[model samples]
Target: MVIVGILSIGFVVLAILLVLVRFVFDLRLTAIQQEADHSQLFRRKINHLRKIEQARHIRYLLIICLMIGIGLAILIGSFLVLMDKQQKLTAQNQIDHERIIYLEKQQKQLMANIPLKKYPEEGIGLEEYEWEKWSEEKKDVNLQRQIESAISKRSAQYFDSFDTKVSLSTPKTISLQLKGYTDDDASREMIKSNLDAFAKEAEKVSQLNNIHVRMITSVSKEKQVVYSVNYSRKKSEDKFNKQNVSEQNLKNSGEKG
Candidate 1:
């Protein structure tokens, strides 16, 4: 750019000098021609006038060519500058596109790892995650049918102690609870064994569903148990009851106000 500017200045300076020289030369030649004509030297005056006109024309042509060259140089410089800027913009756009793709992929991985139960909101960012969970649930609908089929196939083996319940918390581990009624050690052992078999079947189904399975054996009071059962169900119910009462009181207070 600096070189182009310098060359442009030089061309302008040169053109100015050529014009000034031509003007001065034409002035001097016309003055000499007039002096010769006044002295009655017609032939010399005519020759001087003709030479001056020819030289003036040649200088005009040179100035026009120099102006054209300067214009072309400026045009070329402007084109180069525009092309450079365009290339930079294109490269930046490509970089931005790749960055966006990387961020989207990372977001997908994060959402996939987040449990549905832990999801905070139903917004654009979570839409794909919600859809995926919904699709998984749809596919898992056949799990019940598959379990029923397996139970029917083994109806004879568990006819005496076949009562069972399944609990599924979304995006969490799946649990299968088997009930035992008898107090006898043999009966408890048989229930445990049956629960294990059912657990294996549940595991197979879980594999298909891409979920974890937990087998839990629950016995009635008549059955002697080694481990104490947690009363969390009663605790949760109490908590819920208290929460509801508080909410009702607040609503009544607001109405009164």
Candidate 2:
């Protein structure tokens, strides 16, 4: 497009130059004829006028051609731009369609695992895990007890107003999500306090456990609010060793497998 535009401008400039040159030549011819005899000068002047008229006609044609070239160039450039945008839109649509299909397949798989095959409108739906199927040799009873104790202590403060949900990820990691709260200093303080309690409990449960937690609070102008807390736990090698020892002791005691 840029190159075409440049060429168009060059042609227009050339046409203008041609017109100027023609005008100068006619003026010079007239000046020369003015020094001659009247009759001869008149004949030469008439011929020069004819030549000037022809040049004027040629200049007009050049101007018209230049205008047409510029118009065509602009039209072609606009078409190319439109075509590029269309191609991008088409590619984006395809990507979105593929994403939707993938999510649909996942949804179907989840539905098939449930006996009822029912879908909920909100919240995550998960397939329950059977603890009995897990290897007893790898079980960490002491760590489990510690986590339960922490949850119990934290829940005692706001169990009536808030529901508690706990999820365990790995041997060391735990994630917590809290919902429903008015956006106020009190709610914020409660969240902070609960988080601090959880952190403290996690620290006491195993010396080598580190906790990472986040809280999200949403409040509306009408005083309605919702909040959630998410936490993860990571256990160090020392804690893992201690857990293994505890498991061995449990196995040696001949406890329930």
Candidate 3:
């Protein structure tokens, strides 16, 4: 498209140059004819006039060709530009569609495994170990208790709003919700900055509790912000399975004995 546009401009310049040259040539011929009146000069003048006329016609033809070339270049350039833009838009839409599908699948999985009061219309979602509640009868009882304590301490230090909810469960999942405003640019920046600070602060406590943190943020059309944090740790699959295998072997040996 850029090349075509440049070529179009070049043709226009060429046409202008041809017109100026023809004008000068015409003036020169008129002056020479006015100055020459001798018989020999009159014959030469007539022949020269015929040659000038032919040259003028050729110049006119060249200018017309240049004009047509310029018009075609412009038309082709515009078509190419529109086609390129359309292709880019189509690719972007496809990428966005794929991303949406992936996120929806993840959201469904989290909703199935975890209990939640509600889901946002649009936002990032992630899954991690649950650390909100501590259960005495559950495995890893000590770790669960420590995680709950850490979560409570961090929540109290960072957030005191009534809207904030810090809950711990048996598997040790910490669920936190923070309400924020985003009515303007300053408010939006404030929301973003506070969320970052809160996440980092919570994550610091999470590391001490030996758990992972997943932070999800959503914004509504009204510019309200919702930052949700899920903190949890996954039980070691290999160790648990090995322990079950060992217990079964011991039981079989006792029966044989």
Cα lDDT of model 2 by residue, 1-257, tens digit: 67666766676677667667767876766675666556876877678786777777676777767765775676677678879999999999999999997875565445334232112222121112233322144666665555544554344334212334454544445545443333356545654554554444444334324343333333432333333333334543232111211111112233322
- Tens-digit lDDT track for model 1 on 94-151? 9999999787556545533532221112211211122233236455545544543444
Give the C-alpha miss distance for residue 228 in model 1, angstroms: 48
Ranking by TM-score: 3, 1, 2
Poorest stretch of ten by lDDT in candidate 2: 241-250
Overall local distance difference test of candidate 2:
0.49
Give RMSD to native, each candidate. Answer: 23.7, 17.1, 20.3
Q: List the global CA lDDT of all models.
A: 0.44, 0.49, 0.46
Q: What is the lDDT of candidate 3?
A: 0.46
Could you tell me the TM-score of candidate 1?
0.33
Q: Report the C-alpha lDDT of model 3 over 1-257, residue by residue, as the tens digit.
A: 67777777777777777777777877766676666455876878666886878777686977768696876779777888899999999999999999997876565444334322111222111113343323335546666555545544434322322134444552333455443222244533443344344433334333222222222222333223333333233342211110111111112223311
The best candidate in terms of TM-score? 3
Clashing pairs in 1: none
Worst 10 residues of 1 by lDDT: 240-249
